[model samples]
Target chain A: MSSGIRVASLDDIPEGEGIAIDKSVTGTADDIALLRDEDGSVWALDDTCTHEDASLADGWVEGGYVECPLHSSKFCLKSGEVQNLPATKNACPHRVEVRDGEVYLFPNEAP
Target chain B: MSSIIEPATGSGAGPSASGGERPVGAATAAPRGALRRPVEMNRNIDVSGLVDAEGGLLDRSVFTDEQVYRQELRRVFAPSWLFLAHTDQFHKPGDFFTTYMGEDPVIVTMDRNRRIRAYLNSCRHRGARVCRADSGATRNFTCTYHGWSFDLEGKLVSVPNKGGYPESFDTKDWGLVEVPHVESYRGLIFGTWNPEPVALREYLGDMAWYMDAMLDHDDEGTVVVGGVHKWVLEGNWKLAAEQFATDWYHVNMSHTSALTVLAPSGKPKAEIVHRTGRQYTDPNGHGAGFPVHPRNRFDAQTVHKWMDYDALRERLGEARVEGPLTNGHATVFPNFSYLPVNGSIRIWHPKGPDRMEVWAWTIVDASMPPEVREAQRLYNLRTFGPSGIFEQDDGENWSECQAIAHGFITNSVPLNYQMGLGSEREDGRHPGTTSELYSDAAGRGFYRHWRELMNTPAWHEENR
Candidate 1:
């Protein structure tokens, strides 16, 4: 059951940056990170890194990759593939959309 | 790999360029200012033994065990925040100072953009130390071995005989390994290798309030005198730190002779009075024993000229001046300690389980007059310098205790730490855990924190 849920508005996330949405949101139980790529495309991934529990939202984002702050492992948002050492497993990617200035997230099942 | 600076000098074809030359590399020796290389245990380490803090019992072997010391280098020193250098030391770009975090040599320098950075002193190639000078301005550090060079920012800039390596060699992956975290409080800089350790502010906790009295009293702040007085002690580093933390009890016995000479009457005082002061031990293991001189103690006795109570009163007001500016001793957990009385600040560098190097500095308010600064320096030399009367007395006791730990029968028994146990209570006058001036609250708390850190592996697989 993949239902579209509005998570935030465009104003909540600036361009070329990412923000973490977790328990702060009333309906969201698990962590879901929403990122706005440099190309203005919105992407979502499981907030926690597979290698370590560090939040991907806290990781540095450049272009399509988010580098883990813990060990500098770069993970690609599109393919969910880790691009650096110390992190061998990929993050789970989810479907994201922007409609009428509202951001919607379809959470992906954890691997 | 051999780029000779002053060729051969007086040797037979010293280190031929074709390699296969000197069996030992030219850079085998440590750099000019490097401390003695640390000694490590050849056998496996076991840290299963514990210190029962609440029970007031500590295993004697914790101070003398070789394996436990090895574990401490990684578990306690590497992960926790350790004082590296002071910001005042770096007046301009390229200025740097070489220091030790545990036994690991590190260089703290200011880059061209004036950003301070800390790097492992070891070279990326062959592990020879990169920086040699103790303190100076430098453009780059060229490894005496293999002729590899690193820029001020610790980036590998040039490598001699580059064509000898494979075509895929990448310099990006070979820069000097940097200490991952660097932060400063007031002017003191600290670095940590642990990626997920607590924030520096939180690590300091309430200790910052007491430190502010010394470092941040005046608007200009405190400045460390130019040179450092360094010496080696044949004792575990913790003994010195713990003493400074919560052992005011030793002052009477340890310096009884010196007191008789310095006091107006040439007699050992019947009883020492510390009614003006209180002791505090933070949960983070930081501890301080500060004397609150009644505003009128300035009139009854002579305070150090550098202490300038009148100036303090004007700047910080009477309440703070009485609370923090008075004579006191404090330890910022693990090793960094300072005495507000004589302006002696030091780091007890753990050389091994049974040895430590004490590097001390005399700090004064940067705004103080030249005469006051000189008096402060002289006072520090007389009281806390390597050969000072009080320092020697303390050293003798520590060395004797360490010697006893070497014996089989001596180290088998547990030592007592029960002074003021189960008697500590919260006091409104100060924050954190408070106890009487003469108590083992800080000592017991120190060991508890040590046990937790020693047991908590830095690289635990658990998330969060």
Candidate 2:
């Protein structure tokens, strides 16, 4: 049996944007960011940027990356890899599943 | 107003040196014992003996000593007026721009009353930065950590959990620390941390008279045209400041390639270098160097067409309009430098003994037409911006100076500033000490003032 928890539905997130799942609800060390690509594919990563105390859900999502609002450090949404300077550490990737239009977060599991 | 932030205890790092303090009630915060200990100020270095302005000699160790750099932050920067931002940057209440006062990050904002105020950017709670963006409009600066927030006047407005704090925890006692002295001359705003400082006009001295050529030429004043260009350079801050103040002589050789590219098709090097020019050195340490006559096609085509020479001459007198007001380079004491010809105004923000970060902007008369302003902006970007041709030429020389100055034997040798010693004269036409354009009088004046500040412990003593 999968230990995934339902977080949100597919229609809840706008295109090229993200929504944050609170740590209390996900039971993880950090908040999880649920991002929707322009093509409607959903990805999950740690919400806090590895470089600073910023919520990636509040960043600008374009293409396959999210740009940190604080310092403009871009990170790959799918793999959680940092793509710029001022941020050398990569954000942790989180597993996500979409079953019948409902979004399920796999707690701390890797994508 | 009550001062909320106490003076840093012991030898705690300045605002720019230290990261955010440990978060309250967090187990992940660094262990108390692991925190940095105060560094003992170096007593062995004789600050007074480092610069012999009369002899035109400067010790190289001044550029390499960590202790000297630390002391300079307190003595030179804390009391001196440093450029913060321009009035044009703030359009409405709560509009702000972030800048540095010698390495210490600060926020310059317009309060609800439209009064300009500046405060240290560090948060009052756990010391995280309150404002991270370069420029923005906001109602309250909410810290990313712990959700502490401050209003436009830097007043502590809210806390995360009101029930968790004891009754003794008062928000009024934890407001952001204000810079204390904020003033403006023309459109440029300047701030100082010292509670008591000389009046801005008195501190500007003769430099104000010289600056009027550019600042007061038009009735509408000036405004920064574009986004700031910033980059780090591996060089001591003084190297850039002093050069802008009094080293126009370097242009003939250091920027030969730039000259070759910029010079008109048939113009000879002799015509550029042999032109008569003047230099001015003020007791306040400000300096300027400019040609007596227009020397380039750019000035003739762009500057002359836009500037009202007749009105400026009538208003400012012929001595200013014809001389120091023309195309030139100048520095306002320690780090604020500008080039009137290129329309570039910059601050050489000291990062460390061996490094400096340059923040540059293009400024133009507000009354100028859009086309003239755009032309000046492009010209400034091509000549003095981060990737400008002349900037690259100058950066190489400055960085190399820092790279070699750290060598044991290299630092022991003193450098020369004796280009035009004793040649400084009081020309009846201009205020302050004047000399032929090639002199290093301004360099000597700069060191003399620097040494004075480094030796004096308090503003009252220095002024006395």
Candidate 3:
């Protein structure tokens, strides 16, 4: 019972970093961070850090983990599990698909 | 979610035989007769939901509830081991200091026997405080109210008018009530009122290993320098205690503006956020988190680094010196906490549910040269005393949070504590439950212990 939306093209995001897309996970237009790992797989999570009101897009992404720039709390790119202290809960993980060179997002599933 | 809290309406399960009554040594306005009567708290106020399956739950009532505070005075503060004074504070046999066990005023002393003891500050006859001076050396204390004099051992020595009382009135039965359990570890003194309870060593558990990092740095040991600094904050005591115990996350955000000025180099704000540290949580509600430096870069300028680092390494070994004693904050159970390198030890004395009196001291190596000790003292005051840059910012955050929790709806909402949830690991270098530097696992552990003590009225080792 979810819907898919086209968020970006394969060429729109860099291979080892993430870009913020102006789309919401639950249809109300919230910011979602579209991250491309070094292995070339794209993952989408809510741009906001769950611990505090910081932006995940402004954080540093490396080795399949995104480190919150404000306090350095890390979140895993694959499982969305919080990788460090300060942020105790998992970030919202979204499904991503690349077809016909266009990146699609399915974000109704909760993290 | 099925509520784990028993209905506040029902009697629920009470504590063991010794638990139903409010144990002696806790502060109370009522006399002994009233204390003996059973107090029925709001049984319907189930706190099971206060902590959640995800990691943390918000129950602002713990801070604002009148009923809950009353329970804490009995169920939590009464049996818990509380900080009394430092060992060096009273070196002479007759030396004594006045302090608090919860809200009750007490006198901690080194009697003629040279044994450390604590007694209720209230005079036995009329309940007025017997000892008035903050600290001094006196053979005995005389009650200003009625001239009832007590010896250094807290024994009733003389009464003004002997004819006023009957012949059967023995002075032996009228001495100030002594605190039941008194214990010391290294140089710190702690007391409790539970008649039969676990020893302080068992109560502190593995946290003692971490504590040695600060207390056991050298064979000469640590001493309290620069007397004491006292202040009042309009916040709950638990907020202050919990922050020191497990809230390293708040440092980068709350102290950002202050850190900018304190940074050794230019662009201080950037330096504050770039550092890394690990958090440790214990089953006993004790937690500590400290920044791990590459070869002691953080303390390079301090007196600690000036001392023999190689000697410390030889004494405590590499892992201990790096893990617990380096550069961070720690708390022992309820209220005693300290910063390792910064060297400020404090007790958050609870005054009702929303207020606390902070009694702080600066700790330094007793054997250090006078100039080096003075340098350490000045640094401590500059960094963590009442007027310190970091201390001011921390007090503001706690006070503001307390103000918001007073709201009707806001008090019921759970606060977010989900940083680094389910991502804890077992690292040989670190002890207890180890997690990433930014996780709230320590906070969760702290609250879990709080919940356990709040629910169980007794202070048995099993319950702890």
Candidate with top DockQ is: 2
After superposition, the stretches of candidate 3 with alpha carbons farther than 4 Å from their true spots are A1-111, B1-46, B269-272, B297-305, B459-464
* lDDT per model vs. reference: 0.73, 0.79, 0.75
RMSD of each: 19.9, 10.5, 31.0
Candidate order by decreasing TM-score = 2, 3, 1
Question: lDDT by residue for model 3 over B149-230, one digit each (tens)?
Answer: 6777677766766578989777766777767667778788888877665778788887887888888877778788878899
True contacts kept of each: 0.00, 0.00, 0.00
lDDT of 2 at B308: 70
**lDDT at A91, model 1:** 77
TM agreement with the true structure for every prediction: 0.70, 0.74, 0.72
Q: Is candidate 1 or 3 superior in lDDT?
A: 3
The alpha-carbon interface RMSD of model 3 comes to 27.3
* Deviation of model 3 at B217, angstroms: 1.1
lDDT per residue for candidate 2 within B258-361, as digits (tens), equals 88887777344686777667899988788998777632323535756777777777998888777867667899988999887767889999999999999998
Q: Per-residue alpha-carbon lDDT of model 3 for A60-99, expressed as tens digits?
A: 6778988765456799986789988667999888888888
| Model 2: lDDT of residue B179 | 69
RMSD of 1: 19.9
Candidate 2 or 1, higher DockQ: 2
Tell me the tens digit of each residue's lDDT in model 2 across A66-88. 87755567889888999996679
How far residue B383's Cα lies from its native spot in candidate 2, in Å, is: 1.1
Q: Candidates ranked by DockQ, best first?
A: 2, 1, 3
